[model samples]
Target chain A: MADNVIIEAPMPGVFYRRPDPEEPVFAEEGDDVDAGDKVALIGVMKSFHDVTVDTDGVVTEFLVDNESEVEAGDALLTVAPS
Target chain B: MFEKVLIANRGEIAIRIIQACRELGVTPVAIYSDTDENAKHVRLADEAYNVGGSVARKSYLDGETIIDTAERADAGAIHPGYGFLAENADFARAVEESECTWVGPPSDIMEQFGEKTQARNLMAETGVPIVPGTTDSIESADAVREFGDEHGFPVAIKAAGGGGGRGMRVVERDDDIDSEFEEARQEAEAYFSNPDVYVERFLDDPKHIEVQVLADEHGNVRHLGERDCSTQRRQQKLIEETPSPALDDEQRAALCETARQGVAEAGYVNAGTVEFLYQDGEYYFIEVNARIQVEHTVSEAVTGIDIVKWQLRIAAGEELDFDQSAVEPRDAAIEFRINAEDPSEGFEPMPGTIESYRPPRGIGIRVDDGVDEGDDIAPFYDSMFGKFVVTGQTREEAIERSKRALDETTIEGVPTTIPFHQQVLGDEQFRRAEHSTTYVEEQLDLE
Candidate 1:
């Protein structure tokens, strides 16, 4: 069985699953991603900050919903290593 | 007046509008996000409805849902208490096209002023002294250079639809103009979804003064004295006071009257603010905040007029019964914005649980806030949680009372801008009222 890693939010803000409101999401569960691949955004204080994954893995689950309020260190997604 | 008014906003301003609605014998209805179900505004309103998710986009900024909620609640009017969708022309038009009344200026007026270039041109034609800048949007870096050459170095490239320093960049040198101009355009595109920009001569040091005006649909307009908002950080106002210490009696009258004339010529209605940049002896028109502002408390304190009530009355087709001579503002008042920010860490946003919350009391103190004790400061919205207003017969007395008011107000858990406000009250330049817009960001040292 492959071990999974959790990606946490660096700061508290509104979690965004896509680049723009009318655009497609960056990635969904069961999608493969590599290190430095943008996965989410934290919208705070009229500024948007990108959240990137650090390791190559497949996103298995999303813990936070899009446009939901999030706190720092909250788990956003679970990625299983190949 | 409306029998039921729906406040399409959250926090302090929403509460303010709710109180105004009650005063007019109207029922106040509130809409809240998932996080604000038990919020103070919700608890105070006559009726509360769930808008959507906690984040503002899914809730507060959703125009379609807001209209639907207003319709379902049987609200006769919708009052957008600043921020969110207050200045959105499209939203205003949708509301106007709906059965409910929009408690603001006409949507056409909002659209005319939304574009900065057109607003400046209108001001010029209306005999308002506009700042020396382009009245048209520039298409390339060459135009910026041309404007800079015609004017001087250190020109400001600003977005046509942006305000509050959102998409503004100042270029100092000849070589840096291109990059700075490009950055301004990109920010303009990203923030406002408009890439058009224009150039203007940046004032090195100037006082930020604004005049409040109230207008009715019947062409009755009146001016409430001036507020000097010189103490700011990164173009964000922290402390605002009425009856500007920088202006004498004659200058105040002229500025106030000019503001009234400018808006009156524009055929504006409802409560709005006319902003200006006052330098040596000249005051230049900047732009208009088409809705009630955060610092409106200072003006209300000095003028003893409920501006919000007038907003409701005007939307109902009421006329101003008093003449210009009958309106007179007395005394001096000050307002300090209390924001959930860590001043020690470059004023970074600190969102957490507020363990304790208390505001001062007595003769001359007023505090407007959205949160109570033990409430959480969510990071999804603006950091400001409240406003502290104090008034006195004289400016000196006002400053003295401000110190006591600041000391009495207490809050724990999340760090606030209280310490910064306290330091400002004690600073010599600030006390003397000699500070300008850039004074706080460039001169004040916070440790």
Candidate 2:
């Protein structure tokens, strides 16, 4: 976990790699992220929101599976500083 | 009523207002934050628009942006559903001055009720029973101590501009008064930007009860009934039910009548709630919520009245069609707030995507939900996602049905208080209606 920053779930909801499964993910492993890059889509009931990167980094690992449920504070992805 | 009304809110309350608009044949325009682009309320509205960023300060709380959104959508009225800018007199005036009908009380009335001391004085002058306390801010510790001594021990030191328990301190004994008073004042300054505090006689083992009232432009005001909201943690109600078991027929009637008189005296029009604390067969006024309440569904279930629609009608200068005797309540109804919070962990907010969600539905069951199965519960907003309202022919039946409904309900991705509510429904004390305001903190073992 050295040199890696984990993007955690801020609330309880379902995580989506993209807006829909057919669409490309906003961010993926090996992709670079600015401070506010859209990372993933999270859904709770009928409401949907874009999860954004908190700091500049490179996506190192996808810690959560696509469409998987994530709780607040749960790790979703790990980002390594470029 | 206006052909279109903008609902400047999100979540179940917004959805509830939209439903009312649809029933009244008024177009509902929903404004969403960046986080609520695909919210249930947005999808359910006749028209929806993106207001601003995810932060409430930039979106829902931005009165100019919201009113502008309403104008762009051709909405002729704005229904601020509780919180955000609901009680903000400035926002109400802004909406009214913009040539848009505000589906609430007049801005002048709101200003009077928005001030704690002024509202208290008004209620007292109208013959409304208020908790024995100060009519003005306490200037010194000696004053607070004197008031406490006069009112007896166990006084509540409260910030003049406070609600939601932020700047309130309950001093149970004489020794704790000085320190608690200072702490309460500091908290008031830090939170509400007002250090002025007041003292009120604290009721021991009181039941949080409120009367649902509706008023129209034709000088008509009537109360639906009483709701017991005693099951609260941290001063926020988790469950609410109409026909408070703590109140007998006489007490209930008197409480409701007093609330009606208080609102009428204030020249308030539209849907509002008069809150009270009932103890030892007596009811004392606490405050008035100037908009629709979260527990309104319970009253609706029992009364079959569309409160939001009446707000629109009243704002449109229509008189209340039904008088006090004509509005009939047929049964008992209860509501449980479904929030994305882990009840086991001190009810800490658990904002995340709801992986799998299905609300229980059947006869006498009504769900006002703001999210679907896959929508994300945003951390930047209130944790509540929806409400489950159930009605039955009797209070016992409603309680039993509530347990069954909770059992059938399933929400994944985050922990909820469903199990806790189930336990509460079956608890002997709760079943017997013996619990008080402190029930959730003192009786229930959340751990």
Candidate 3:
């Protein structure tokens, strides 16, 4: 059985999966990510901040859609630890 | 007239715009964030759409999303009330490019006024008495010293792209100019994305007065008198009143005429304000607010001219039907900005759900608010939830009426600026119109 960990937004802002429209998404469901790996970006107050994964895991599901508004501590994605 | 107009803002200003739209027989479409999904502005609008997140960046400041929402709602025009994107030249251009009417001044004109030095140059060229300051950015401490030598010491180093008391520093002595100048430049870059700084002669006890002006596409401009907004804390206005007790008839006329001439020369259209700093008996031009202001209600009360309605009319290609003489201002009106702040605790924001909210009512009182009973005053936005405007035939009557109205108002669950306002109304210096911009912090005993 895999241990599920929820990735939460650190601040309130628009959650963007990709850094830019022309760029690929930072991380995707079913993709393996290491601790401290960038998963998404939160844009607020005319600037962008990176959201990173906390542990080495496979992204199980993205709880928030791309470019969706998010609040601090809201569950953004689910990850299953390796 | 537009079939539907989108108000790209939230709170009392949004509701204010909706009221204007309804009066003009135009449908009002409101945009809200996740936190403001059930806001009063959303409920009052003819139609409401969710823009994005709870924070302003993802929602209110997201120009692309707001324009897209306007398109989706079939809104022919957009009114950005006060804050957010109200003065954004890029947003105005975007709205224009998107084939929707931008209900403010021309974007190009806004661009010019957005830069402080350029605005000063323009005002000077228009025969308006501007504060003795650099018409361009100062590059070194030498230039600051030269300005000080020319205009005397106590110089103010300000950001060329900033306003509302941000990116400003006062150097009392020539020795402090170098560091203060560098600090001002850095603050300008951080706040306005412009590192340019300019020097000005700092006036120590100046009355903060501003004149409201309205213009249309045609060659018509009118001044709607002036408002004294000296009652402020850290440059944030707390109380404002019209028929500035600081100015006599001659001074008032000169101030208003100078403002109209300056704005007209800039080819500015729609509703705007020309702020000035008055010291001794002379008034010097400061900056132009290129959009409808929070204190427009005070001007509206005295002038009896609906500024929001005119913003819509001007954007719809309507001309100013009335001449300058037609704008007859009467009575004394005061506007108290009621923010959810704890005055005892250094005016820190105290955002919380309103358990019981009851605004003052009856004659001589009008309350423009965004929250209701049980509504949460979200931490994601500005602390101000409402404005209580009181009007009377005289300044004395207006002050007395405001006191009664403030007394009747009731709110629970969060600390408010009500107690502070009550104290201000009772203060002798405030009643005598002797308070300046620094009075709130320097003189007032908050305890």
Candidate 1: the clashing residue pairs are: none
Chain A: TM-score in each model:
0.95, 0.90, 0.94
The TM-score obtained for chain B of candidate 2 when compared with the true chain B: 0.90
Best by DockQ: 1
The candidate that wins on TM-score is 1
Tens-digit lDDT string for candidate 2 (B139-158): 88788778777877678888
Residue B286, model 3: Cα distance from true site in angstroms: 1.6
Q: What TM-score, to 2 decimals, does candidate 2 have?
A: 0.80
Query: What is each predicted model's overall lDDT from 0 to 1?
Result: 0.90, 0.85, 0.90
The runs of at least 3 residues in candidate 2 whose Cα sits more than 4 Å from the true structure, single-residue gaps closed, are A1-82, B134-152, B156-199
Report the CA-based lDDT of candidate 2 relative to the real structure: 0.85
Residue B250 lDDT, candidate 1, scale 0-100: 95
- Please list the residue runs of candidate 3 whose C-alpha ends up more than 4 Å from where it truly belongs after superposition: A1-82, B134-150, B157-199
The docking quality of candidate 1, as DockQ, is: 0.58
Which CAPRI category fits model 1?
A: medium
Distance from true location, Cα of B266 in model 2, Å: 1.1
Model 1 regions more than 4 Å off: A45-49, B134-199
Q: DockQ of candidates 1 onward, in order? A: 0.58, 0.10, 0.09
